[model samples]
Target chain A: MQDQPLHEPQFALHVEDLTVTYGAQPALWDIDLDIPPGVMAAVVGPNGSGKSTLLKSVLGLIRPVAGHVRIFGRPIAQGRGRVGYVPQRSAVDWDFPTTVLDVVTMGLYARIGWLRRPGRAHRDQAMAALAELGMQDFADRQISQLSGGQQQRVFIARALVQQADLYLLDEPLAAVDATTERIIMDLLKRLRDQGRTIVVVHHDLTTVRRYFDWMVMLNVRIIGQGPVAQVFTAENLRAAYGGQLALIEGGAVDPADPHP
Target chain B: MTAVLEALGLLFQPGIVQTVVLGAALLGGLAGALGAFAVLRQQSLLGDALSHATLPGVCLGFLVAGSRDLGAILLGAFLAGGLAALSIMLITRATRLKTDAALGIVLSVFFAAGVVLLTVAQGQPGAAQAGLSTFLFGQAAAILRTDLWIMSGVAALAAGTLAALWKEVKLVTFDPDYARALGLPVLLIEGVVTLLIALAIVVGLQLAGVILMVALLIAPAAAARQWVRSLGAMVWLSAGLGAAAGITGALISATGRGLSTGPVVVLVASALVLASMLLAPERGLIWRWGRAARARRGIAGRRVLAAFHGLAEAHDDPAYPTEEGMLTTLIGRPGPGVMERLERDGMIRRVDHPPETTRHWELTERGHDRAKRDQGGRP
Candidate 1:
């Protein structure tokens, strides 16, 4: 609960000069991004555009070649356990032998402390998170038996169980059923209303404005960053997605137009 | 029958056989407990690679001591296994080689070096490394009370570690990225798990040779997975299954002459895997097959009902009953039993015509609504 300095505005996430390279290829290059607290924000880009890299770098999962990240004006080291992460659904082997309740309980592993098991209170908390996501009925079901949408819900529920102040999700809506998308979006919005910051790595550009209030258009480097109304302009899309997107839309799109 | 009785009775008698059984069982249980993590982490071959890599350490331990001192050799094997695990991890991470390739490379190279070292040790004067190669396919007869104590200590350590870090290990194995996000020491947990797996492999060295040790590690867990839904159940069941297999194999070896315990134990574990796969509830092959058969029958029955409903619609009479033979001819090879099952389920019923002809069947009122729903459109 350390107070921020007088000069520093409280950004839920702040990255300064972040550059990540896999071997000779740079994934994210010299990027600076700031997302204020309590806004449903998005990291928008096409494939291989470092949307995931930004999240990973912010979480300090992948060591960036340069730059440091902060959550709420503090370095990641000092901000530990305050940020919740939902990795890509495909990041894990879904066939692993585990129950839905067990996966959600993973969020509290840090709070449960090292070497200590999750007690009944922890289980109730996990169950409550699952209930929020409408996955309470699947508490005992094995994860592998779930659909893609259910898997995404379970992932979001796991993040919710963490009860972190700042949440970073990697494509929570991708390939999910319509119901799951709405449920997750509602949950994220609820978190935002409660003054929690949620940043999503988003791919579907058409729905970006509708889904997020804050946007950071990214293609290796920052193309645009600010309110979606300002950062989601057609020109920004062209810069972020490049000719690959132009090939699909066939022309420039207006951010105010709300459709490409 | 007498042989079986003798084996069972010999297990309870106080002797070296009991010690060997206890040692093998403890090692098997430890392997099962630790292997659960390795297998869950998709590193089943890590144990295999580490076990094979323990060869040179065993040879070196023998050579250094000029005698087959069990503790020194085990320590050497433990170090070698750790080194092998580290090498495999590095090779996979630093190079383009995949995990299996790294495991294969380390396993064969270390095993070959161990073989060569064994030969060299044999050439040395005053070398008492005879039967050192028994480590290749564990010589259970060589197990002593002290070996049992070692196995017990290792098992206790594995159990304690698992108890302390069960949640963290599960989180890491399932998703390390999230574990890192939660500020858990993902790498440290992984290292500890791998180190324990290596210790388990080294302990199992005397019961299941390097060639068969992987069996003890994987079989029990694989089998337990079929019968359980939770990781806790899987690990506990796997460890228990492993212990049971160990005791059974040791007992069998005692009842017979010239049967190697390692291969016997491995065979027992393999049978457990096979049995679990075939017979475990819900997830088992037989149960799956039965479910599949039922599904196929249900689909065929619905198709028949829909077809019958269609025929009635074409005839513009909802009660239009068709000859059984015609229905069979039209459906063409959905067995006669399929329609009978539909009738039994009240979806269809048999009827008789005024003329002396074969009985006819027609969709019931409920079946008509179901068929229409299945069609998803009006006539």
Candidate 2:
């Protein structure tokens, strides 16, 4: 340890007894999780599995009934600068009166502080982030003009400008082209290789072992979590999916299979 | 109240027409700028609720002062508008009803209560004055110098806050969740923005009245959104359009004896919205129609050219001359001007028809290249 702020230095994300409710209905119940630093992770299960609820709870946007979520070895609130988020594209209004560059610039507004505006240097930084996602030419174009994949790239660019130690993305690859999917995956891997942790809410079960090294199977509660090869087995997938097993590919992973 | 009515009558006198117009413009500008945020956040009805909610406050202020005091009336209006907003939020939060139902509930209930209060206040001593009713439909000519000063002070505060918190406000309007994730005080910022909007509505309460003030709040912003693609431009244009509507309406109404300024202003604002919808450069209806028309022409031209290419391919000859009848049969008769327009653009040229009754045409090199390209490099 470098004598930094850490209750547990090994885990980049720590969630204990995390419970969330929507009105009287429990969305997530008494969950516990520990994800070590610098691993690309996936949270997978059938639809309505509390994946987005879990992420929002960790971000402190939703009020959870009971939970403690730590990021980079600190409380979620204290780790604001250390965590970046790529929310679902549906979370924003694309037709809002703003340009792509301005949307990306918003990522720096918190760091830029209040009562001050972003200047040339800040814009240059935003331009560079946009360039990384191949969206530099669209910096001045209005956001409503972007395609779904371009919109996803713009969001990833915004997150990139944060340069946080931990990143959480909700279904970035869903509905994107294979090329776009590869580009985003490569970008995430690059970030992880630089010692940052990446956690994605993924839907594609076939790519789980191929794309991630750590897995967290969640369905209202944590069915299993740990290194992908260790926790991602046929038995765990069946338990997480249950009656909705046919909804997703619960049969994708076989207990006897090797890296299929 | 008599004095206020006297002031209204005085503005019609030769010297102060500009003063009344200026006052109305300021009111419109303030409403328009704040309304930009309200419209963006999809809470335009919130303004309606807040404005109507101020009616009871105006009655209370009149009762408490025993006379018409503009400052007391404004403060009371501010508080009441704020309370209405809070009530709407609470209604939506405490129950499953969405914002629309909540706004409607607060608007009608608060306005009905105020009407009842107005009747009660009419019976009390000194509250029997007639000018207090001007707050319902609004009489712009009734604006006093003190009222103008109060409006200016409120406008200044709004402008100052918007300039200082421009980034946060834009971000909050666009994505409050992301703003919160970035450690911004999402709730506090939202609250402040909502309060500023309420303040703007309160200030416009007397100028446009409770009934028509929401037009100034929503119309200008809605119109401006059609013309601009940036929040900054939308707000500025909204303010300008609002001011324009205000001045035109006030001038027109002031020319007539019984015309109320509020309805006239709303009509002018609505006209501007209609104009923006029809004529804005990119988002306008006419522009979209024109673009669609041009696209249709291009597609038709491409198909005609591709038809020529098809004839050349079928005959296994590169320089085949196709008769008009044959071309028509290949793809149903091209529109009458389709061939002429293509020839005018130098994509095709007519040839003399020998031993044939119809005109024949051949594609120029340009037309041939285009035809080949549209068909993905085919024959």
Candidate 3:
């Protein structure tokens, strides 16, 4: 193991003037963002808010229209085997009759390259991953038998098996039980402690303050992004979550004070 | 029958038997393995289309060389079958038409064109022209030693490729999205799986014929799926089943004169599928019936326990004593036979001290745990 590399104290992933378009409609407009290493940062927004698109651009799954995304000073492709991705749970059809262990082992496919079978070492690595998520009991159970939370955990385990320096998880907590949510949050904290950067697409606003240390408040564009306490305030909340802004902003008032 | 047996005995000489068995087995195994992915991915119909599409290429090959060289015919078949697969892919991707409809459209049109080509080829003066119709019914007896060698070599090559890419194939077929997210070349992997299917169908066309080759690809795989859960297991099972079908078809056709080997082989494969459907452990009819019977027994056991639970909750004093009517109410169906059955099972006992015509029921120790687990209240 080597010492973690550093670009700056407050930046791990850097996106410069990123823009993407689907045909004529711009899915993402000019956007610039930075996320430092070892922090659980979130890209929070509503539907079609470019939250997923941003992650895809970073992963190089979709080519950006106009900018570069660098992982620790190198392009994403050069960072292969160092970045892990967990796509949305709904993005895949679940009725294909594969077990949890079978799916988790897919993480090794890229590492092994084409035309080679996963050897004994790969199976051992996969089992370690399953045990990490406490899913060893269901390892042989078909993926379709899993609840939403278990499926999400299986995806996380797959990412864990990748052993990447940075993890990009999309809506991992969505539709999960509270215990599963806690487990994921704890796993993210552990990953961060190990000096890995984790970028998550989060949905639950209530738990966001407690769960994340940094935030990329987005609504088709960045509202504000930095430390959660200072950067995520009433004004930024209003900009990002427009209609519910007052409800959130109104709760910010100190209750003991009589004056506005 | 004796004469047929004697004839088969003559053909069973080591050289001939070894050639036919090894050739058919290799061919069957390759087609079956590739077809597992095709059937799993719901592209079984593509096998049909590609098999028919090889005809024009065969004609083109004959037309080009004016000879029946195996190399020329194989090249032509590969080109035409591959083009057919590519066209199917393009149509589905470029148009709103769904896969099944597009496959149907392609299959009929290409097959009709092949029929027209065959008609035209009948007037052509060539030695190769004699066996063009043989491709339709598959002349197993006419499989020369050279043809066997080519088929065996192609089968080995295809099987090797499949084994090499098995994991990638399974991943993409199971979940293309996850494969894409991991930066696996999904299009390339899919193209490989498709190409393997096309290659299998093309190679099989001369042995199994266009009309029945689709059956060869799908039946063994579909049959194998009924018996296995893992992709590896399914592939192995499919290969075994296919080899068996091929050998049996060849033997029967060789021994019994006037039978077409291709249709016989397909029929053998279909019979395997039907047998698996009826007899497999997980999804078969027998297993399903067994499960249903067990469920009925569980429900009967629960009804007895429900009667006991009713008695335990009956009185205001709640000392757990109740009359006969509670059993009927708790069970949700009024029947004298249910009470009698419950008593016979020793799950509940009829009260003897009550007035002669009426009786009360109470739980045995076994009944308590059964009821608790059912309600999910406790164990």
Top candidate when judged by TM-score against the true structure: 1
lDDT of 1 by residue, A52-134 (tens): 98899999899998987878778787687788899999999998888999899888888889768889999999999999999
lDDT of 1 by residue, B295-318 (tens): 888788877887898899999998
Least accurate 10 contiguous residues by lDDT in model 3 chain A: A251-260
lDDT of 1 at A178: 89
Per-residue error at B26 for model 1, in Å? 1.4
As a whole number from 0 to 100, the lDDT of residue A259 in candidate 3 is 22
Error of 3 at B250 (Å): 3.4
Give every collision pair in model 3.
A12-A35, A12-A36
lDDT of 3 by residue, A61-154 (tens): 8888798787876666566677888998987766555788888999989888887878889888988898878888998997767899999999
Candidate 1, residue A126: lDDT: 94
Report the candidate with higher DockQ, 1 versus 2: 2
Which of 1 and 3 is the better model by TM-score?
Answer: 1
lDDT of 2 at A8: 64
Estimate the TM-score of every prediction.
0.95, 0.94, 0.83
lDDT of 3: 0.78
Q: lDDT (0-100) at residue B287 of candidate 2?
A: 99
Residue B272 in candidate 1 has what lDDT?
94
Candidate 2 CAPRI assessment class: high
- Rank by lDDT, highest first: 2, 1, 3
Compute DockQ for each candidate against the true complex: 0.80, 0.90, 0.43
- The per-residue C-alpha lDDT of model 2 at residue A23 equals 80
